[model samples]
Target: MRKQLTQFMFSILLLGRAVAALTPEAAENVPFYHIPSTIKYADREIERLNKNIQTKPRLEDSIQFKAFGFHSDYLPVLSEIPDQPRWTLDLTFETYTGIEELFLVPTMERRIGRNYNKNAPYGFPSHFRVSQVFPDGRIQPVYEHNGKPHLSRMPLFIAFPEPRSSSVRLEIFKGAVEENREFFALEEIYATSFSYIRRAQSVKVSSAIESPPFWGLNYLFDQQTNLGQPLGPKNPSLSPKQQKDFSANFGHTPPGCAEIEIDFGENRPFGWLILYPALWPEGILIPGYGFPGKISGTIIPENQDGLRGSSSEIENWTGGSPGNNPVRLHGKGHIGRWLKLKLSDFPQHNGDYIFAMGEIRMYGNGRLYPVSGIRLEGFPKTEFADHMFDGYVGGQPVLFFKDWFFKTINGNTARYEKQKWEYTRQALEQRLDTLLRSTAMSIAVTTVISLGISITVIRKNRRKKIIELRRQISSDLHDDVGALLGCSMLAARHLEETLSNETDILKVRRIIDSTTKAIQAMRDIVWVSSDNQDSARQLAEKLEETLEIYSGKYEVSCKHDHLLNLADYRLQFSEKRDLLLFIKEALHNIDKHANATRINLQITVKQNRLKIIITDDGCGFDFRQAPGQTTGQGLISMRERANHMRGIFTIKTSPGNGTEITLELPVKKKPSPLKPRETTNESN
Candidate 1:
């Protein structure tokens, strides 16, 4: 119990520090920095904090510490002409494909060595434009980025609008400038839709430096980034004993030239082949450890030994450290039932030069061929040769290109968010330290006392506010639902007395309508209290559904464009509830007072402000006497709701003229006094 109290006090101290750090000047600079936008980001931070609390193998304390291990034999692509007029990369697809966004990885690593470079290379374009090219050679601009210079080493994500085209074009207005020379350089580019990355069938570049082994055009579509392979933060590094046991369970390779043959039972076309390198035993990842210095592949007929017949060399790779980045080789148009891989010049581990590989994969017809459970053979009955095709590396499944890209990009983004939070935390700490040093001993004591008193008062006030909120919600529920339900019951009782008349049928419809309104009122009240429904799109959807309930009585015309922008923005709970209620009340007023035939509701979003206009062609009331009119309470309620959301509400109406109601609201509301999810003692 005492330990629990001590921990609670420590937490309180941290809370005090945070509260003190958030001064008026400091608060303006941080926009919702305390709130996490995604669950993955929050999980990452929690895991990191847990690891920090518990001591383990201490890796480098840097952003790259959690990055995937990667290496490539070639450099990033660059423009051939340093001062070229315009550098263009055109991607032609085999069929028409829709591209919603483009993801570009800059040339961060100038060269692949023992470790990947963290800095981006020179000559990255400052501004660029992406367009769609038709088969008739007409180009339409789809997206453009003309913001500040692209200097960050991170990947650039550009969103495309209205994308459905046969081909795409990426053009640079001005190439990157360095030392009075201008050139465009990029490590990789990907056109992605909502679900998957769209791989272009062919690529065309206006000018590219196609130097072999260092720089080439292939680097642009290599699917390799400097961010390396996606790896977990707590990936285990086996101890010497563990390694020994693992080797005993999943045998290791013996020294010498090793050849493995895979028979497909029938002739099949293979376009891509991947060779996954062995995992580093010590966790100090040397990418291509124990991988052969020289590798060769050959294709042969089925059911025949590769050694007994003449085989054609399909692919060859020499001298490359393929860390977590698997060696992917293309064998386009190669049709064979049997594949033979010859590996030589093996790297030495301990005292022997041994050849070890995690897995081998072959792909054709845009799908991975099932290699698991397929019997493999070795030329000389190589020890542990079958273990190489187990579809796993260090007990973990080998990741595909798209899966790896997704994980690596998400990991990099999470790291970036972590770095931002860390910077903000450090700034807060520094300000806190300054504040502490500037305060005298008496002032510090008085401040602590005042803080304690303030905390107590705040708690009491918070409880009172919660109770008041519950009371407000309770009163609204009573007025909206209870009154309607009561009217529904009274109408039902009235229906029995006039059972044979047409008036009874009309009375039955009124009762059904009243009951539905009561149910809808209850549903709205429940929706308003829900914590999850916060997005503007959800609010708009709810509003549309509410408006649809009145479709039978009046002709409803609703227009809401810019849904994408609304989808991206979020609204506080109070703002969402109030705005929804305000619109519903306006529609309700039109139904009750005005004999309207046609109703029009148009909602537009501009400059972070949401405008709602509702008009009806009906006998309208006098705007001057609206407050004293029969429908005065509904108007007052709508105005109060709008005012609560910090919005502007106006009604323009005159006798025999149509009524127009306009509401202008900022999408984002100021911080409310009440916190989220706080439970009150009052019950419904």
Candidate 2:
């Protein structure tokens, strides 16, 4: 039995050691006597307690107690579990090494799930209560509900008080619960202590809080001395009256307490402040008196939603309807930081408290800022033409003035300026072209008419000349040749009748022969003069006969060859005339001057030129030297006639030699339609 008891004691010791080892340091620090949950009693017992209590039964008596025992098997309660707390309390002792005074104020977030549990016996609480304990075994209760206390609820608590702390033991508590529980839960506990001391001091509350349009005021605390006015002294440059005005415009005065100081800091160029009067919430504006000052820091306007008007007159400040109130101004000097207020030129009446100032921001350096103004003028459309006219009129500035003047003054203008220059020039050119053509046509017509008239006149004159030549030839033939023939016939007749003796008869025969020669000469002359084919042929036959009559005086021969008919010769009168003249000259030359014992004469007519050759063994004279000695006029006359008929004449002769004369004269002949018999005559 003794061994069994010892074993049991050993097991108990081992169990205690395990429990001690398992407990955390934070859990050990907590006071063991604190209630973990509500304790409940029987109903009859609560009634008895109520009769034994004071005038009203305190609901605290109905409280029931439940022991919260440690069990490894049970799940840990949330209050028994450790957590990070919101409030921390601290205390410090000056005389001792330990703590002296401590206090804690916790920040509460009314979270539904964390502050209360629906699983608790009670419903949602109308108020919350908590108790704090100190190391000296003292306790205090604090209550709060909906950010206030129960006495603040009047009949419930005597007083709703603020927490207090001094240099002593400290305690901290909270009012909370699990979100699912119907009752509130307490999660954190804190305790501390420190030493305490007493002293006299001055405190200053800040005047930073003010009505709209008033700002830039700060609070100061001074423990040195007690004085009624917190702000020391005003700057000497500002008179009392000016100070009053400044305060009135700003809507708040500096705080009056010793230990508190008001600092306007630095007054920058082009910066101003604005205030709104208490009576006029919308009547807030920058004061005109501070227009040229600089801004120290940022200035925010009050009732900024009331701001209105064009942006032209305002610099550095946003101007619009005052939806987002308070325009902000920033920076240091005149150019970008200044604000100008045109309050003196305000359009509306200034009466009562209708005027208020908000903020004034000034912009420094006028060159960097822009100012705007408005102007009204009528826009003229017709006046633009007047400007052009002024430029172009006399004594005015004009482009290409010389060219314009030359054209305008000389009655010449550009094509576009003239009415119908193109049409008129084209018409004039066409008219000139037409006139030239007409003149050319007239010249051609006149030339043709004049040529026709001249041709007609020439033809008529040629016909007349031909007729006159025919008439002259006819008269010569009749008068000269006819008379000669008659004389010849009379001489032959007279010679035959008057002769009787033999010598005389022979002389008569010689006279008859001479008459016969004269008759032939007359016939030849007539034939040449007549220019007819029958006359030409008759003359040829008669010459042959006459040459035969000379056969006794000399060995004379005559040959005639006719290549053309008599009718063909008549049609060529000019050729007939030329041929006749050539023949006559040949015969006359032989008869008078040949002095030859033998002679031969040949005549041929072919195509045009007539050829005649006369050859004689005669006493030939030097033709070059004897032109004057010999009767050579017949040869000259034959050449002249041959030239007239476009023929050739030639003579060949030498002293103690025969003479040959060749005459070729052109004959214009027409071939006979009927063939004529060829005739060749040879006479000796």
Which whole-number lDDT from 0 to 100 does residue 575 have in model 2? 58
Model 1 lDDT per residue over 1-684, tens place: 234335435544644554455444553354343323322343566467445423221212222211221112222345553343266788865344466556676665444575644464445666678888877777888777664666556556655566467578987766665455556677767675533345567888777776555457776765545545432233245433323101211124554555667876567787678777776656665656677778888876543454434466776878455544567676655777778877676666666554567677787776667653333333333445555665556545556444444444444433444444455555555555555566676698889999999999999899678756866776677777677777776867677566877876776877777687777777787667655567677777888888898899889888886666667657876887788888888888889878999899887777879888999999988746655774578878987888898899887888999899999988863344676786678852
RMSD after CA superposition, every candidate: 36.0, 49.4
Rate residue 537 of model 2 by lDDT.
54
As a whole number from 0 to 100, the lDDT of residue 419 in candidate 1 is 49
Cα lDDT of all candidates, in order? 0.63, 0.37
Give lDDT for model 2: 0.37
Give me the runs in candidate 2 sitting further than 4 Å from their true place.
1-495, 498-522, 534-562, 565-579, 603-610, 619-647, 654-657, 665-684
Clashing pairs in 1: 287-323
lDDT of 1 at 385: 55
Worst 10 residues of 1 by lDDT: 57-66
Q: What is the C-alpha lDDT profile of model 2 across 301-374, one tens digit per residue?
A: 22235432222222333222121122224332332222223221111223311122222112332211222211
